[model samples]
Target: MEEQLQATPICGRHRALNALMAPFGGWDMPIQYEGIIAEHSWCRSSSALFDICHMGEFIFQGDFVADGLEDVFTFSVQTIPLGRSRYGFLLNERGGIVDDLIVFRLAEDKVMIVVNAATAPKDFAVIKERLTGGSFTDITAATGKLDLQGPLSRYVMVEVFGEEVATLPYFRFITLNILGVEAIVSRTGYTGELGYEIFIPADKVGELWDLLLEDERVKPAGLGARDVLRLEVGYSLYGSDIDEETTPLEAGLEGFVNFETTFVGKEALLRQKEQGPPRQKVAFEVNGRRSPRHFYDICSGGENVGMVTSGVFSPMVGKGIGIGFVLPELAVVGTPLTICHERITMEATVCELPFFKDGSVRG
Candidate 1:
């Protein structure tokens, strides 16, 4: 039997706007408000508000080393300074990625861990099993998250919130008063835009959503648009791009892993590094507007070499773009490949990542 889908705090607002609803990560999420392409374009040019309350949040308050929290993830937790966040992964014994997450260092001994909605329960279990002592608690039920992203996001945030938000550098966060409560505003986002991820009390999220949308410069965008934006910037989608069977080296994300640190999967990763990964992730551009879809075969010299994991018709690039795992020899840039699904075949060329490069993410 299929599990019952969960709903976010601003679900009613999405329905009132007549959004196209669909299931995503066990949540009944709005797939699109206007349309995927339209919303995608709007987000690239202006600001787009997103209901991200479906993600999970956890609070860990204790000694990083004594509590055994320091060795749980790929990156060292002690290195992250206060008021800043770092993105990395938790891995299984086989060196496969369990989840890609961000850890916010709220204080010397306190950190907030934000993870994917679908992997929250398992992630908590795994982390808990590894910890010796720490006050670890799941805070997802009490927290609501919303993302404001795009080139004009800074302007809109300053107008709606205040000038203090304007000075926040990338990857930094601040706790500020919003809707009569303390909220965390982080300069972090999935989309390749200058944006902020706001975490407020669940009950006050609806009010904050309304207030943000009240601005003329801000428009509500759903997951459909968010996917396109992230894909254009070559960001990986957890379930599709990386999973328990996939390693960071194969996914071209070895930079996130620190071999110097002792973690659960470090030994396997070191062995894999010495042996080299069998498969490698590749970015490609389709010859035309025919977008590659997940599970589609990646062919080279009429032989199946891999499968597409994520693909989209990008408005910014004016072509179809995709990322997939392919044979190491065939993953080179400028190598011609064929994406095939049943009788349909699309011509493509192996390319470098970030298909759309002129994004306002750093600006």
Candidate 2:
């Protein structure tokens, strides 16, 4: 039997636009409207709106120390200042990443956790089991999330929301009024651009979506463009780049893992830190515009060394960019590599992250 797919509150709006719809993370989502490349290009220069309400949201209110909330993730939750959000991993006992999530410090005793759609149930279960005491509840069904991303995102957000959004600062959030409801607006996004993520009641999502589209500068972009945008910046995709079998150390996300803070998988991570991760994530660029896709073989010295995880032909870079795990020695920048799948093969070179660097993310 086929599984039922969930729909966001803005699903009708997407259908009305005659968007190309498909299943993504167990939800019926729009893959594109005008087109993938066009939307991707628009987001790079202007702004693109994404319906992200399918993501999971959880509310936890309790003592950070006494309730074991402080040690649940790779980062220290108790130390996150109010109005700020911290990104980190939820790991398993073997030091593998269960999910990469963000914890928003909503109040002194309350925090909101945002997680990927497909991994939400498992992430919530692991968090609940790890905690000895806390008022934790899933709020995904009642909450809605929209990501307005790109160079012009900040300007659009300020114009629609208010002047308070103008200086929200990266990683910080402000509670503001929108459509007669309280919404949490955060200066954070996955596109490696200056952007905002708006969290509001599920019922009001369509109104906000419509309201934002009223601006000629804002257009709806689907998952296809989102994938391209994220890959161009070398951001890791949850299931594709990092999963329960991949650790943060191997994924080049050690900076997010606080060694000073003891948490689940700390011992294993310590062991790997001393012994070194057997394989490391590498960012590479193809010699031309031919795209490398997921599961493509990464070759070196006439042997398959790794497999492509997240990949795409980036319009911004005018070439194919991809991230994959390879032998530690082959992860070095400037190393020559070959990406192959079936009859297609392309020469590539190990490169540093953020394949496109001129983004207005800091602006």
Candidate 3:
């Protein structure tokens, strides 16, 4: 039997705008509006709004250390200062990533854990089971999220939400009243641009969305554009670039892990660190405009070494770029590779991350 796809608070708005809808992470989501490339370009040059309510949110209001919340993620939640957010992975017993998530320290004893939509159920169960005590509640149904991203997003935000959001540093947040309700505005985003994530009540989301789009500066962007924008900055997509079977070490995300603190996957990661990972993540650029695709073989010396997990023709870079797993020896920059699938083959080279570096992410 086919599963019923869920709808976000902005579903009607998306359909009214004639967006291309598709099932993503169990939700009926907009894949693109006018077009993928057009939306992507818009986000690079101006402000782009995204419906992020499909993602999950949870509230953890209790002791960070005594309640066992500190040991839940790769990073320590107790160390995060109030009004700041931190990104890290939730790992399993074998050091494999359960999910890549962000923890927002709303107060001394309260946090909001945001996770990818597909892994929310599993992540919630895992986290609850690991905790010895704490009041952890799934707040996904009650919350709505919208991401406004681009170089011009800050100006648009200030004009609409007031000047209080103007001085928010990256990874920091401020609670502000909007439309008669408190909304958490965080200076963080998936797009490699200056952006803000607004979390409001589900009932008020449509009003907020309408309010944002009323300004000519903001246009609605979809998941398709979102994927390309993230890839240009080398952000890993949960199901594609990393998963429960992929560890942070092999995914090139070990820096987010704190070995000083004990977590569920600490011991296994320690062993892997000592032994070195057998395979490593590699970022590569295609020599031409041909795009590599997921599950395409990555070859070296005429032998299959690994497979491409995420790949797309990058308009900003004017070429194809991809991230794949390869034998550790071939993960070095400047190494030549061939991406092959059936009759399609393209030449690629292991390159550094951030395929497009001139972003307004810090501006």
TM-score of each: 0.99, 0.99, 0.99
On residues 87-158, what C-alpha lDDT tens digit does candidate 2 reach at each position?
A: 999999999999999999999999999999999999999999999997999999999999999899988998
Q: How does each model score on lDDT?
A: 0.94, 0.95, 0.95
For every model shown, the clashing-pair count is: 0, 0, 0
Model 3, 1-363: lDDT tens digits are 898999998899999999999999999999999999999999999999999999999999999999999999999999999999999999999999999999999988999999999999999999999888879999998999999999999999998899999999999999999999999999999989999999999999999999999989999999999999999989999999999888999999999999888799999999999999989999999999998888999999999999999999999999999999999999999999999999998999999999989889889
Query: Candidate 3, residue 324: CA error in Å?
Result: 0.3
C-alpha positional error of residue 358 in candidate 2 after TM-score superposition, expressed in Å? 0.9
Candidate 1 weakest lDDT stretch, 10 residues: 155-164
- Give the residue spans of candidate 1 off by over 4 A: none
TM match of model 2 to true structure: 0.99
- In model 2, residue pairs whose N, Cα or C atoms come closer than 3 Å (at least 3 residues apart or on different chains), thus clashing, are none
Angstrom error of the Cα, residue 272, model 3: value is 0.5
Model 2, 230: alpha-carbon shift in Å? 0.4
